[model samples]
Target: MNATNSQSPTIVLVHGALTDASVWHGVIRLTQAAGHHVVAPSLPLRGLASDAAYLESVPGPIVLVAHSYAGSVISHPATLDPKVKALVFIAAFQPDAGESSAELNERFPGSKLGPATTTVVPRPGGNDMYLKPEAFGEVYAGDVAPDVVSVMAAAQRPIDPAALGETLPARATWHDLPSWALVSTRDLSLPPQLLGFTARRAESHIVEVESSHAVPVSHPREVTEVVLEAVRCALS
Candidate 1:
């Protein structure tokens, strides 16, 4: 777990639905500038278990950072390698055993938090879907600038809806790991209060930023600070 040794906690960036790892470009550069290695993986988004497994496959100093739907991916029951230091959630879901995004959203029906149209659909190919651009911005990037939202929105990939529906079998990750959460004040997709609830649920060290759901892009400085803090806390 020492940087000098074989392991150094590299930040593993997990993008939200309908987007690729590139969505983290700005944040990645920022993190690297701060002298931390980052890995923003392109998740299959087909199932929570599969996505978590894919992420664990990356190998080496990994710290799980799940955005939006990928939260479920990190909270999976199986242990992500011991090399993983901690988790950073960017307006991401933080769930327990037997929970799914659909079940969680059901708690807040008809959320103005999301876009006028929802792109989270049934499996595009098999068990995943992606959020549409309008929904991506209106719901996910409402706080982000129009231009940034446009580009990040266009780069989004489709995720399978099954990922949303897939419930967690083991909630150990939530309880076992040390957690940090960055709340996007202007997020329309999940609603601000929902994020607050998440902070409380995970008992995380909460940091609220005046950004959109895409906090990593909308507020890279703030995001970088939190990430840096996580690294220090982990190594300490």
Candidate 2:
């Protein structure tokens, strides 16, 4: 391959709370099949600042893909970094300055997530949380198979409460970069209208799908297509 052609921008996938990088398994497979480099790093789910810093540490010129709460991370330095060429949000939170995942979760009227979740104190000063296993399948991954949802529920990560309430920095790459979004119409974790609000605010190229919040797992083809679109934009 010529040097120019060999230099495809890397696709960095960031997973949100209640799930680890494993959530992007299907999306990674499809992106890799399309001959693009892809990496899904585990977000700490401790706080947005730490997660964003971790994402920023990756060498860039990357197509940054954020799922769920991760949208908040990539919007900042994760996208603002000079190496980030474009951004793709898959049913993710995209908060502006002074906004937060906790705030946005209640911004619209469709989400049933808050009541379904329960918290556990991970330490003396803070807490970590997870969705009730019974509600996990219906709310977060409705389109996924039953067996898979069972496995996902068993392995779901606990997100630190700080991550959700942490306010964002003053600036975000979405405010200035080329961006694309996959709006999951069936998403109960982050409602479709809420996703629409964020995507429109960022002026992102939008594609709507009838999947749940776990769109990467339930609608990998759709997620992959959006990622490829961002990759094409980065390459151009």
Best by TM-score: 2
lDDT (Cα, tens digit) per residue for candidate 2, span 5-76: 358988999988888889999988877777777788887777888888888678867889999988998886
**Residue-level lDDT for 164 in candidate 1:** 81
lDDT of each: 0.74, 0.85
Give the range of the ten consecutive residues with the poorest summed lDDT in model 1: 1-10
Candidate 2 off by > 4 Å: 1-5, 77-79
Candidate 2: 10-residue stretch with minimal lDDT: 1-10
Cα lDDT tens digits for candidate 1, 11-95 = 8888877677876788888777666777787887677788878876777667788788887788787645577788888888887
Model 1 misplaced stretches (Cα beyond 4 Å): 1-7, 109-116, 119-128
Each candidate structure's TM-score, on Cα atoms with residue i matched to residue i, is 0.88, 0.94
Backbone clashes per model, in order? Answer: 13, 1
